[model samples]
Every structure is written in C-alpha cells, then in structure tokens.
Target: MSGTLRFLLASWKVNLASALEYRLSFFLLAGMMFVNNTIWLFFWYLFFARFPVVSGWEIGDVMLLWAVSAGGFGWASVLFGNFPRIATIVSSGQLDVYLSQPKPVLLNMLTSRMSVTGAGDFAFGLIVFLWAGDLTPRGCLLFACALLLAGVLFIGVMAIAGSLAFWIGNAEGIASQVFGGFISLTIYPTGIFRGAAKVILFTVVPAGFIGYMPIGLMREFDPGFAAAAFCAAAIFSACGALLFRVGLARYASGNAMTMRN
Candidate 1:
C-alpha cells in the first residue's frame, strides 16, 4: 500500500512538472472550463427565473445537482483523465509497457495523467454548491460520501467503455457518446423521468444516483434513500471493477513478440 501511494505521488509530481512546462496553456484550459460551467449555471438560473419550478425542484435544488455532478466529474477528470483515453492506448498498443510493469496497470493508468485544469471546474462546482446551501451536518456528510461514490462510478463507466476498444479496435466515438449521454441525464431533475426511463437511468446509466438521488435525500432528509444510493454506488463500482478485470484477461497485446513503443 505504501509503495503504491509512493508511485502515485511520484506520478503526480511528474504530471505536474510536465503541465508546468506549458503553464500558459494549462491556465487557459482551466479558464475555459470555468467559463463553460459558469455559462451553464447562468442558463440554469435563467431557466428557473422563468419557470420558478421544474416539476417540484427549485433553482437551488437544481444547483445542488449540478454541484455534485460537475464536482464529481471535475474530480474524475483531474484524477482519472487517462480513463477515457485508455481505448486509444489499447488501440495504439501502448498498454504493452504498462502490462510489463511490476505495478498494477489500473493504478498506473489512474496516476498517469493529472489534469491540473480540472481544479478550476472543481472550484466552480464547490462555489455553486455553497451558494445554494441548505446543508445540515448530516447532509454534508452524505454529500461527501455520494461524491466519492460518484467518482467511483465515473471511473467504472470509463473503464468499461475503454475496455471495449480491445474488441472494437477503436471505441473512442462510442465512448464519447456514452459519456455525453450520462452528462445530459444529470442536467435535469430525476423526478421528471419515470417508469422505464427512470429504471434505466437509475440502474444501467446511473446518472440519477450521481446527483439527483443524493440531492433529493439531502433536501428531504431521508436517510433510507441516502443509504440506498450509497449501496447502489458501491455495487456499481464493484461491478465496474469486475468487468474491467474480465476485459483485462481477454486483452491481447497488439505486438506479442517485441517490447516496442
């Protein structure tokens, strides 16, 4: 465990050094993200200003959803930026080096890229979250737990999508669509979705639990719902990890005979 932590820290340091080499570009990327999310918030504010309530959710409730989802995504992008690109690595036969290493490949991938720009998105999400506050101590605790679980889910989904590259050769387009679909779902109130749509969102896609469900529990002070969301997150993460391992066993190096870059 200690060795793994050390490797991760070292990797982060290397990534930071590389990013600093292009400081202007890094800050510009961060600035762009800030502007994008701020614009999204503005649109929502305008939306609520006109409608006052969508279904039963207010502007603050919607903001909470955005806060958790955007914050969760920012963390994922910062910590696991390489996840979505794993497909490219596999397709390009770049995963061979990772497979030859003594360390865990997944761990290596997780720590390989540290997106400094995601820090801006995280900061923006947190600011919006605080500004929309109705959080109790318990709500705060639950939110933290939910955020962690959401990150796990995000990584899990990315892994599953990336693993498909092994069979499909190039799955980047599919992965992009999948990610976009998930993000689109989280932008609205879950209450607006029902029946089969709700079931699919809550289970297969899980955009519901990413933000809506947890925020609902916080707003309503429902421990049972919170517990359910936590359990779902755990199960989803475990399933995702298991799926990745299955995919790894089936992975064939594009070049089996030589150690080539």
Candidate 2:
C-alpha cells in the first residue's frame, strides 16, 4: 500500500513538473478555464438577480454546486489527468507502454499527465466555497467530502465511457459526448430536473448524486443520500475497472511509437 502510494505521488510530481515546464502556457490555460467558469457563475448571478430562486435554490447553493462540480473535476484532472483521454490512449495503442510497466496500467496511465486548466478550476472552487459555503468545521468537512465524491464520480464515469474503445475500436466521440453531458448535468439544480430526466440523472448517468450534494449533503446532511453517493462512486469505479480489464483482451495495437521520460 505504501509503495503504491509512493508511486502515485511520484507520478503526480513528475506530471506537475512537466506541466510547469512551460510556465506561461500553464498559467494561461489555468487562468482561462478559471475565467470561463467565472463567466458561467456570472450568468447564474444574473439569473438569480432576476428570479432570486429557482426550484428552491438560491445563489449560494448554485455557487456551491459549481464549486463541487468544477473543483471535483479539477482535482481529478490534475491528479488522474488521463481519465478523459482513456479512449484515445487505448485506440492509439498507448497502453502498450503501461502494460509493460510494473505498475498498474490504469493508475499509471491515468496519472501520467496533469491538466493545467484543472488547477484553475480547483482554485475557483475554493474561492467559491469561501464566498458561499459554510465556514464551520462540520460544513467544511462535508464540503470536502462532496468534492471527493464528485471527483470519483467523474473519473469513474469517464473511465467507463473511455473503455468503450476496447469493444467498439474507437469511442472517442461517444466519450466526449458523455463527458460534456455529465458536466452539463452536474452544474444544474437537481430540483429543476423532473420525472424521466431526474430518473436518468440519478440512475443512468448518475449526475444527481453530484448535483444534489450541495443541498443533500451540505445543507441537510441526509445520511441516505450520502451513503448512496458513496456507493454510486464505488460502483462506477468498480465497473470501469472491470470493463477496462475485460476490454484489454481485445485491444489492438496501433503500432505507434511511444515513450515516457
């Protein structure tokens, strides 16, 4: 366990260093993403200014929603930066390098890169949290939990979508759509989605687990929902891992040259 943790840490360190090599590019990418998220928040601000509330959600709740969604995504990308690119890697036969390594293929591949834009998203989340979240210890703890669960959900779901490449040959487009759709669903208020949409969010796509955290886990502390969220993340992760492992049997070599420093 300690050795695995050390490997993860070393991978993250190297990824960060690589990203930092081009300092200006890193800052610009991260800053641009931060500004983009802020713009969306501003649109929500304008929305709330006009309506004051949407399906029981106020500006503060919306802020926390963004915080969890973006922050969760940010951390996941910064750490397991390859989650979104799993399909591309698999389709391109990049997994050969990872498969040859002593480390776990999925973990090694996932941590091989760092997204500079994600750093900005993470910063935005903390800032939004300070602006709108509960400052108390309990509130802070719950918020952290929300972020962790959100990250896990993103990684797991994306992994499953990406792993489709193994079966279908190239699933990059499908994976991209899933990524966009999941993120889109996560930012909106869960209360606004009803009937079939809500059901799909909670069950099919499971975005409700992330979207509802601001109210369910942070505000009211619903144990049932919290447990459900944790279980959902666990199940998705397990499924993704299982699928990837099974699919590896069918992975074709792209025969492209690849290397790692």
Identify the candidate with maximal lDDT.
2
| Model 1 agreement with the true structure over 1-261: per-residue lDDT tens digits | 998889878887787787678888888888888888889888989988999977788888888777777777778777666766767676666677678788888768666776766767777667876787656787677666656766677777777777787778777888878778878887778878979998998888888877574455667766776676777777866675666667677676676453321
The residue-level lDDT of candidate 1 at 181 comes to: 88
Lowest summed-lDDT stretch of 10 residues in model 1? 252-261
How does each model score on TM-score?
0.89, 0.98
lDDT of 2: 0.94
Best-fitting candidate, measured by TM-score? 2
What stretches of model 2 exceed 4 Å from their correct place? Answer: 259-261
Residue 69 in candidate 2, Cα distance off native in Å: 0.2
How many clashes (backbone N, Cα, C below 3 Å) per candidate?
0, 0
TM-score of model number 1: 0.89
Once model 2 is optimally superposed onto the true structure by TM-score, how far is the C-alpha of residue 187 displaced, in angstroms? 0.7
| Reference-based lDDT, residue 66, model 2 | 98
| Candidate 2 per-residue lDDT over residues 18-115, each given as its tens digit | 99999999999999999999999999999999999889999999999999999999999999999999998999899988898888889999999898
Off by over 4 Å in 1: 135-139, 255-261
CA lDDT of 119 in candidate 2?
97
